[model samples]
Target: MSSRFKMSDLGLLCFYLGIEVQQGHDGIKLLQSAYARKILERAGMGSCNPCHTPMEHRLKLSKASTTAPVDATKYRGLVGCLRYLVHTRPNISFAIGYVSRFMEQPIVEHLNAVKRILRYIAGTLDYGCHYKHGG
Candidate 1:
């Protein structure tokens, strides 16, 4: 490609966007602990208790469900950050997607759901995808 456009070597990629890349004999491991922690901090859940799962199993959310309303802007912002986080943490994809549906008119229940996700993230900060050389 050097023959086409001018480009210089930026050295081995250790970080890109918010993902952290680690190289070793076994394989390459991608992490996003920093990004996850920042999300928790932004949501004011930095010291929150960790949870086993991203969201409660069998949890169902509906717009018609009566509940106190929450700040739509804040709720949407959290969901947006979670969406970006899905790039390296697919485990929370479903949970984030489920809670995102209420961004237009998020309620207290939805906010709680979002907080649960943050708690789950706190427990799994080191969790990420590892691409083995051969598996």
Candidate 2:
């Protein structure tokens, strides 16, 4: 492939984009712990207490929420970062999607929901996808 394309041989993949890679005799693993941490720190929740779940049960969010509005730009940024984190953290995908609906006019309630996701990530940052080697 190098003969056909101009690309530098960076050696075995360790990190690409925001995902971390680990290769071993058993298999390969894809992780985004660092990226996740960055998101939490950027949102000023780096030291937030961890939660067992990303969201509360029976969570009901709406475009016409009655709560006061928060900074749309900041809310969007957090939701966007959380979305990218879904690549290796499917567990939080649904919660992120739920909160994303209010990106245009996020309220304190919506932001609180996003915070829960960050807390959950803090507790499970090491979680990731693993691919086993075939026999």
Candidate 3:
């Protein structure tokens, strides 16, 4: 397209929408360390220590138990935002999908679960999907 029309070369892509894009010898890697940090700071949990896992495997979420309700819009928004992230973040897909099931009427417990995910992100800022060049 650049040959057809007059356009400036921008060089290699580095960042887009807070996501870091880097080309390596093997392939290209997509990461969102900046976005993860912003999420921690926005939630005022930046100082909180990181955890190995987002949530325990035994953590069970049931619709029967109605713990105090929180902001539906905010919770849903978070879930929706995370969904976009799952494109290059398959590791968190299971957890995020589980929590998203209750977006319509999220409770305090559900909110806490979401916070845990943020905490997990803090620890795994370097985590991302890597695609090989020849793959």
Candidate 4:
């Protein structure tokens, strides 16, 4: 409260910590398109083909799968970024959560799965939830 600590008005919040905010008559909207793009670039998938779905249906991933191991640190970093993006992109939450389970021992297949997610993000960069003033 102003009665307590001194504070300055920052005006309407449009962007913060990578999340984009928009205000209008309908309501406020939030998205992370910029953040998602950065993720794709970090993984060298900025120009990858877009996918309709985040992950293929009936997909199954297990540690027993015989695949070459990937860089644990890199995989973890990507997954971590994706997790933060989930705040404004819940559509990819399930996919990210699924692949994150292998952070300790990521494989080539897991990396591919992550790439698929990035591709999906590319196709749906404008996809985000809109909160109307009233239900």
Candidate 5:
């Protein structure tokens, strides 16, 4: 790919495709800390209390018979962006993947759950995956 196309060397990738990369002695760490913070601030969760987990342990989302009401478009957009972040940051992969299952008909409970994930990200902003330097 590089042989065919001329590409400028950007030096150690601090930011790319919206994800932040930090180089350390041990490895390269990928994070969406700033992005997550911005999302929370936009969603009015910037100063909200933090939670241990993104969603309640027993959350069972579905196009269900019993679900609270919320904005579908907003919910889908949130899930979609979160999915994009999962590419470089796999820490929230499972949580985001689970909520994505109900994007077609997201409810208030689902939206709240997604916000919770955002808040959790707010608290754990430093959490990310590490790739060994020499690997």
Candidate 6:
């Protein structure tokens, strides 16, 4: 593909798509901080207070809730973005999964739960995994 398209060398990769890559002697580090931040901005929570945890412990969302329903499209979009972040943020996997269950019929409660995850992401933007050089 490179030969056919006459692609030029771009040197080391720093950012790709939404993931940031850092190469070093020990290993490679991947991060999606920018994408996470974008998600918040899209949700209009760029300057929101960060949360210590993505979700409350043992928190449960109901499908048959009495609370007012929120916008399904917006809720799904946020949840989908969070799911993409799971590639590098396993910490929020459970919480994202829990909130995702209400995507079809998200309520204010579910939206709040998802917002908590976003707030948690805001606090941990620089957090990412470092893979050691493998043999």
lDDT of each: 0.92, 0.92, 0.83, 0.90, 0.80, 0.91
Would you estimate the TM-scores of all the predictions?
0.92, 0.91, 0.88, 0.92, 0.82, 0.91
What is the C-alpha local distance difference test score of candidate 3?
0.83
lDDT of 5 by residue, 20-131 (tens): 8898899888887787777777677788888888778887766774766778887888888778767766778899988888877777778877988987877787787788
lDDT of 1: 0.92
RMSD of each: 1.7, 1.8, 1.7, 1.5, 3.0, 2.0
Better structure of 1 and 4 per lDDT: 1
Model 2 C-alpha lDDT per residue in residues 17-100, reported as the tens digit of each score: 989999999999999999998998999989989999999999988878678999999999989999999999888889998998
What's the C-alpha lDDT at position 71 in model 1? 89
Candidate 1, run of 10 with poorest lDDT = 60-69
The parts of candidate 6 lying over 4 Å away from their true place are 1-7
**lDDT tens per residue, model 6, 1-135:** 986797888899999878899999999999999999899999999999998999988887799978999989999999999999998888889998899888888899999999999899999999887899985
Residue 37, model 2, lDDT? 89
Please provide, for model 3 over 1-135, each residue's C-alpha lDDT reduced to its tens digit, 9 standing for 90 to 100.
978999998899999876799887999999987777766776777878888897878999976675799999988877776777776678999999999999888899898998888878788988998989876
**Regions more than 4 Å wrong, model 1:** 1-8
The ten-residue window of minimal lDDT in model 6 covers: 1-10
Model 4 lDDT per residue over 15-108, tens place: 9888899999999999988888888899998888998999989788888778899999999999999999989888788999999898988899
Error of 6 at 65 (Å): 1.1
**Candidate 5 error regions (>4 Å):** 1-10
- lDDT for 4 in candidate 3 is 94
Query: What is the Cα-based TM-score of model 4?
Result: 0.92
lDDT of 6 at 67: 90
